[model samples]
Target: MRAHLPLRLTRTAAFAAVCVTLAALAHSLGGGTGPDPWAAGVGLAVVFALAMALSGTERSTTTINATLVVTQLGLHELFGGDGSAYVAAHQHGRGLGDALGMLLAHLTATLVTGCWLARGEAALWAMLRRLARRLVLLRPVATAPLPPAAPIAHVRDVPRRLLFRHSVARRGPPLPA
Candidate 1:
């Protein structure tokens, strides 16, 4: 058990290190004022997903994916994110808040896509289910089967007179030819 603990910790650290390295590379490459904020996020996400997939262990994949997410979040926060250009262009040299917001949005998309690619839908759904079960607000609804779809009751027949047809013109006197 003690040996397992060290291994787990090492695995976690390795994952975090990989994420930080990738983040650094991304920052160096395109994390600048002129570059699109999504470029680094997408590049890191793709690389992390491939790495996690190649690891060949579900637990390791999940653990690594989570570590990458948290590490990326911290890095984004620490470095003021990669949206300076956008903020400068739109807000005109605004405060760090907008940059942080952009960082959050980018990281969220990156992490979600990375997790999905690494763990697949089943794993994500299971995690969501577990979270739902644990949350007090969702506990009751988590196990509840979806209510049967409402039956489509037939509408009452409409009176024929109520319907209008262009072919049924009034039988008034014929117009002069």
Candidate 2:
């Protein structure tokens, strides 16, 4: 879907396609009540964009992601989450708080996912830097000295002058009467 986008429109168009796909899937799986048809995915995308914009203006992504994750966890626990008894009791419950919680959860997950992906990219960049240092083409031009190589040794017998004496005769043997 994003492949058709020009170099400039590429990112926007891809996100638009994602929003459309998300809306269609959500509607189908949610039995027409999952979320609003045009609003589900696109809304979240907007939320993500907003989150990114907010981060640019205010806090960092890590802080935002952490805040979202904690909020979502609280909401899930409150709603009788995953398989909890409390969540089961509120399966049909409705309130302003619940609505707000749902909104927060969706936004949090989206932003947190984006943050983690950016982090993954950062790690990849660091690895690429290390790799560049190893490759001759990408390595920095430096005049520094190289490290020493491994040493080699050979064993040889020493002459008598260099060796300790093992002889029984002395220099005075010829002069003895």
Candidate 3:
């Protein structure tokens, strides 16, 4: 358990960093002319790949999605975007409600793409998961501990002797008689 602490922490930190970075990029690109469609597609592809690679389970995917939403909202509040104006001009809304509504609308679209990407990844990695299971299943079995023996009345058997002539038998110390 202790050994896994650093790995978990590293994964968490890295995911957070990516979320923040992506949020900032999204907020920045979402401003002004509302980003080029090509750019948006490329960005979505990057997000899909990142989410698929980092998210291990449904819970993790939910957490990451939440993180992305929250980070984007926070950055939008701090840096301020023209989303309100854009929404009021194009869509039929205004003010904070409009902004939030637009945000939610975009969130739905983004999440759909993410879901598609995750499903694709699941299909692709199914084979990898099976391979992993096979590797574990095929691993060499550890030798069982020898049972304790009663005190020997006679010493006919040598106390220590090589159990087998092959190098494979030397993988561990020889078992006692």
Candidate 4:
């Protein structure tokens, strides 16, 4: 269980966005009017954020799909407006067609979102694995200690004349132009 804190937080944010957007769209289309859209969006965000945090990284496609489906259903119900209005709408012969349409839309959205998140998860994990491999390969290797430096000869004892002998002769001063 790698601590993918950034990835987890990002996924949480994406999930929240999806939840709020889809729920709001579905609610409006279904003729459900809510008092506060901002409150609904924030509520969805907080709920999904907590869900994602508890669920951890969803690496499996099936798991992602399942999670998304549940989330969509929850959001749909949440934004479905007041119970009295919902009951009145249904009582007035709002048949199965609307319900079916909403379900279908939610399912479609879930599948698409799940596929996208799964693909991204796979790519990110693959990149992380490659980076880990490269880092391991770059580890410093242990080697035998370098040989000690040779001792310097005592140059102070050498005669200065001998050292200077055979040295380059001093150049004469340049002739006047």
Candidate 5:
């Protein structure tokens, strides 16, 4: 069964909040002063939610971490500026310290978000399993025993004339011999 709407929404909100927070932290640490684009954050959140919903709930921790890393990088760039500005800044040689700071922030965010999501995934599956078990247990049971069937007559016990008489009925009249 698919996840409920409330659960999906909560998961999406959590993901978006973590991404935005991490992006803001990384930007500030990298000496950025501009505000992040709210539109970008909302767009990314919608995309992320759709992807997660389509991908199903039983994702591995590694997969979650990898996705988080990609999202963090994308958000960092989006927050820093548009794609072109980020590329230009990188080409101009950002300091190693700034690079390390951003890396550390992204890494930390990935680890934390991955763990949180992994735990939630496990719990959801476990709950679903328990619910299924309970449903099975609650199924209606047949309490009454079935009636016994009639006994069959052996072919050898019946007379041959009686069988022939029963086989062909005298409808109207017998055919002319």
Candidate 6:
């Protein structure tokens, strides 16, 4: 059903869903202070960044470039310590330092993911150019063998016929005065 949504809307909704799901998961575990929730968030960032990089193939990629990154950061900060993460941190009795640490980790992950994406974009661009060049060189142009000639056929010798097949009896024209 979500497929019906516009791409941007779907991705925005998915981002929201991720944030909500992460919060819910933290809550389920009694708070954002799980053993290494930030690590999990890092993994999520990696997946998200990879998806964004792969999505470079789409036309919308250019339009939604900054939006994607901003969304990730906003969601990260929102779900970070003292924000949505607070709920989990409070419940788990995690110290302020830990919460801050977790936030730091998330920030680092986001930045790293973004950097990886930058590198990935350059690499893909170079690879695409290389691929295009190779394709052009390897393309079977004049080097391709010609197809066998087809057998010729004799033309039909049918004579032209009048549209009206039956001849009408000629009515004698009235003598001109």
Best by lDDT: 4
Query: Per-residue lDDT for 75 in model 5?
Result: 67
For model 3, name the residue pairs that clash: none
Error of 6 at 148 (Å): 23
Give the Cα lDDT of each candidate: 0.53, 0.45, 0.53, 0.69, 0.66, 0.51
- Candidate 3 per-residue C-alpha lDDT over 1-177 given as tens digits, one digit per residue, 9 for 90 to 100: 121444444444444445445554555555444444554445445544554454444333555456566544554444443557644443444577776787786587546544554464445456656777899999999999999998879748756556654446337777899
The sequence of per-residue lDDT tens digits that candidate 2 reaches over residues 1-177 is 012213224334433344334434433442323434444444546545543433322234565455445433432333232434333343335677876765565565547564764464355446756676669676668888978976867769856763556646545546656
- Backbone N/Cα/C clashes per model: 0, 3, 0, 0, 0, 2
Can you list the residue pairs that collide in candidate 1?
none
lDDT of 5 by residue, 68-166 (tens): 777776666566666665655543256777767657766886789778877877787789889988998999987898788889877767556764665
- Runs in model 2 deviating more than 4 A are 1-95, 136-177
Q: Report the candidate with higher TM-score, 2 versus 3.
A: 3
Question: What is residue 128's positional error in candidate 5, in angstroms?
Answer: 1.8
Candidate closer to the true structure by TM-score (higher is better), 1 or 3: 3
RMSD for each model, in Å, please?
A: 21.6, 13.5, 16.8, 8.3, 14.6, 16.2
Name the regions of candidate 3 deviating beyond 4 angstroms: 1-14, 33-60, 81-93, 113-131, 142-177
Give the per-residue lDDT of model 4 (tens digit) for 44-130.
766677657654644688876777777776766666556677656533345788657656776887798778877877787788788
| lDDT, candidate 1, 40-129, per-residue tens | 455455544554443443444466466567656655444443456533543425667875765666576557645654555346447756
TM-score of 1: 0.32
Residue 107, candidate 5: Cα error in Å is: 1.1
Better of 3 and 5 by TM-score: 5
Report the Cα lDDT for candidate 3.
Answer: 0.53
| TM-score of model 6 vs. true structure | 0.35
After aligning candidate 2 to the native by TM-score, how far in Å is the CA of 94 from where it should be? 7.6
The 10 consecutive residues of candidate 5 with the worst lDDT sum are 84-93
